[model samples]
Target: ADVDYWSGCLAPDKLAARITPATQALVAANANGHPAAWNELRTLASQHGLLLIEDSSEAIGSTYRGRVVGSFGDCAILDFTQPGPLSCSQGALVLTDDIDLASKLRLLRNRRLSDRGSVVAGGLPVADAGIGELNAALGLAQWTRLDDILARRKAVEAHYLKVIQSFEGIKPPYVAPDVDEVHWFLSLVHLGTRFSRGSRDDIVDDLHTAGVEAAAYCLPLHRQARYFDNQRPSQDLWVTDKLADRALALPFHAHLDAEEVEFIVQTAKDASINVGAGSAIYL
Candidate 1:
């Protein structure tokens, strides 16, 4: 299938333009737990007779329009990677209320054909992709402690928001009014327009110098060498490109204390200023 990629969580006009006759489904990530874009996307999908697939991987505890994010789409997915809310090392969950869909998913996980199709009596003909017993146990344990985990993450988010508020050139991730909650996988900050991608890298370097790990949140996938296709028409992704350049991911976890957050914020502020001043360059 030829996948039509949108540049990040899309605006209504951009999404409408991308929906060709062959577009069967619309898949989107609930970026940083904000759902305004997703909500809009859902509306467009309904209008266009497309299945809306929500990738709520990083937004396990987030809500949009009083409904949980994962519940918004026809089907939704959650990745339980180390960085995700319900970490079980590595696994993923697909959720849907449709019984047929659920049954098909179960069969797929166990590498089994549909009951109507030719079946093997002893085992599946192919390798099973089912979650192991250990991973399932870990996921269950994490699910039981989800509330506590969410609370601690929210506390850390509060600390970062408080400290980041005073920094002039840094902007915290925006939460839409309809979003009742946010489960921050990592605290993201947008460096001011005055700063370039190089300056953002400098800030990351300075944070490492201070013993705090930081990184650029994401790079445009289409711009990456591995994914770049010269045969495809060169498309403008100005918004995504600008965001990729300015966004920085800061150290974030439920275990982070107030003091650690303070240090990180201070270091980031100092680094941005130093980089802007041109005094921090070593080479």
Candidate 2:
């Protein structure tokens, strides 16, 4: 089972162009808390007789076309890990409508560890893929209060957006017409095309020096060592490459208040100036 890389968001046309005879599934992620175009992706997958797997790991509470993200696809997934809305420290979930598939998932999840008595939460064997009772309890606690959690997170998002206006070169976040709600996984900003990847790195370094946690965002898998493709330079992935070079991820969590958000944005603005792309120039 090999995977084919589609350059950016799972736009139906771009993804369809890459499907081969061997393609058996379509995995589309609601990235950065914003839901992808699930309606289009589902149609594309069905047209090709391929299964649709919704990756809602980064978009737990987000909605697309008035429906929650996890409700799309033949099967869907939600990850409970650090920084997620329903974070249980480390664990995930597989949700499916097909009873047969649900049974299969449950069986496979504990097949290797079922005999181990130490594996709790039923006599069932627990594998690395299975969440223990403790984590499950924690995730459930958060899950039951998901509405309040998402609401608080939305408050934080509002703070960031209010302050984002003062930060030059960064526009208001974009939401497609079809998307109903967005609960971002992180506070990400894109610097203008004037900045190089190295300059973006420098800004991150500057943030670190000032004791502000920040990071670069969306490094294309094709350019990394694990899946390095020298031919990527000649591919139709200019948007991907350009985005990888200029994107930045700032510290974001529900606990953050308006003042903290201002400081973080101001720190980024200063960092940009240090990298020669002044605040007035590019983000």
Candidate 3:
């Protein structure tokens, strides 16, 4: 909910404009495995004395300006969900250099209440919240093969990019010049402006009908039913809204081989063409 409240990428000037007496922290993501302007954000955060928190969940192996995604902020978080490179089945890891912050996080994760109902903890508690031995073992096994897994995923992404380049009205994901490595969790494509949200959805549905799993991924949080608040003025997230409407997430996984990628790309192209033709007819 906190993230939903302040979600879209704020420009340095826009961020400065939004600051007030109550603004104490700035939480940002290296959104969708592409590096954000973290150095600028860090400078802004420092200028305003606000803590910079990073969510590098989808960017475990990604880097910004030669430094890893999780290394820029005061504290950062990584998700080890099944979709991520380091799949622990279900868990997360927090990164921080501060010992005091680490101790506080330990307490938060494993708070033991005393008989009087006050929390008690000495050092890092051996709490139940910690990863189980079996899950730990599984995560370790996967971690050991991370290099090969990442390479496979990168290969799949490259194939998709190459195939997508030939298709009109669709573009591959953008990686900034500063982003040295991108461990893409999803092979996202952006439809041209001629494509509406309905057009994008139609293509996704067509892909589904053709046995290719694709989706109109990542709707803007402000537009979601739970996050919309009448009391608060709506943010002018024009770019966010546009991206939400056009972005399509194609099937992506390390296990997907060249043949599978070729089929998926072909299906996606066909779906886009069909949808684009239908839109023209309606016009």
- CA RMSD, predictions in order: 5.0, 4.6, 4.6
Error of 1 at 264 (Å): 0.8
lDDT of 1 by residue, 1-283 (tens): 1111222355667668778998999877777655536667778998999988888888888887778878977899888886667889867899999898787777677753454476556433443667889999999999999989989989999999888888775554566656677777778887777788998898899889989899998877667776665544335666777777888888888899999999999988888888875332211
lDDT of 3: 0.75
> Model 3, 89-200: lDDT tens per residue?
8777789998988878876665545423765546555445766678888988988998888888888888887777766756445656666887887888777767899989
Off-target runs (Cα >4 Å) in candidate 1 are 1-8, 36-38, 112-127, 230-234, 278-283
User: What is candidate 2's local distance difference test score?
Assistant: 0.79
Query: At residue 52, what lDDT does model 1 achieve?
Result: 85
| Top-scoring candidate (lDDT) | 2
Model 3 misplaced regions, further than 4 Å: 1-10, 112-129, 230-232, 278-283
lDDT of 2 by residue, 1-283 (tens): 1111222255676778878999989988887887877888888888899999999889988888889888998899999997888888888889899998898788767654545655445544434477888989999998999989888889988998988887777545877778888888888887875678898899999999998999999777677875553543326665566667788999988888989999999999888876754344542
**Cand. 1 TM to true fold:** 0.86
User: Which residue window of length 10 is worst by lDDT in model 2?
Assistant: 1-10
